[model samples]
Target: MDFDEAGKSLSLEKDEYIELVEFFFPAAEIDINKLMTANEKGDTELASDAAHSLKGAAGNLGFMELSDLARSIEERARNAQVTGLSLKIKELKDKIAIIEEAFEKHKNS
Candidate 1:
């Protein structure tokens, strides 16, 4: 989805919107990686923290799917129900692809 509407809703000019998209992508990518590593290491607290941070940022940027999925993973980690954490991570990866696509789209616009 083009983020023009999301930007408009937030009262962002195109340039500002593009910058925000650019900024979020890199940080979100790092958070995803952190989630993966922490989950692998069985560090639930770390995983929860990473997911929670990413979720809020993603939601702010109108990436609801990513934000909601991250919230699920975060809650699961916090509740000590990380049985399918890998699947959750994979879902995040897929959501990140959509975010990447949005980034490229907005980058060119």
Candidate 2:
């Protein structure tokens, strides 16, 4: 994905961008875990909070699709809509996997 080039084009310092990506990598995992726990415990508020947090972090890293998906999850959680959350979570995980792969490749490059 050429995150370095993307950062340059966006006027973000390379080191700053790398740090942001690193920060998000672990944060996303933690947030996803928390969201799953919240869902299992039927704690909609916590799930919403987790999803909201993920959305902000993803958006900051220019992960527009992830951010959008997170936003939808957050909204659904807030509304007590759990019917499709599982599917959404799976989709989000897949997206994160792709992003992680790109991050790893870019970092090594």
Candidate 3:
């Protein structure tokens, strides 16, 4: 959640990075919901797709923690391994919440 580092790594100014993150937050929430639904339905394909999308977006924004978590889910889903996905999805949501809190702090500053 190092905003300065993320902005530097992405070659974005602080304001630009903020704008990108503002967009990312809501989209990430949607993806998380999709992941939860996919897990509940045991739809490996849909889960994999959702995780992959979230992974890529997070990585692009230098949210490596989130990206890594999503990558695990994507890899598992790709192998049709649905076991414990609910827990993993919860972990993902937790990471997202942490990131959101950091973003809020940055905005308030």
Best by TM-score: 3
Model 1, C-alpha of 29: deviation from truth (Å): 1.3
Model 3 residue 8 lDDT?
A: 87
Q: Provide the TM-score for each candidate, comma-separated.
A: 0.93, 0.92, 0.96
Residue pairs in clash, model 1: none
Clashes of each: 0, 0, 0
Q: lDDT score of model 3?
A: 0.93
For candidate 1, write residues 1-109 as lDDT tens digits: 6688889988999789878888998898899899999989999999999999999999998888889999999999999888999998999999799779867876666
> Ranking by lDDT, best first?
3, 2, 1
Off by over 4 Å in 2: none
Per-residue lDDT of model 3, residues 2-78, tens digit only: 79888988788989999999999999999999999998899999999999999999999999989999999999999
Off by over 4 Å in 3: none
- TM-score-superior candidate, 2 or 3: 3
lDDT of each: 0.89, 0.90, 0.93
Q: Tens digits of per-residue lDDT for model 2 on 1-109?
A: 6688767876899999898888888899999999999888889999999999999988877888999999999999999999989889889989999999989888888
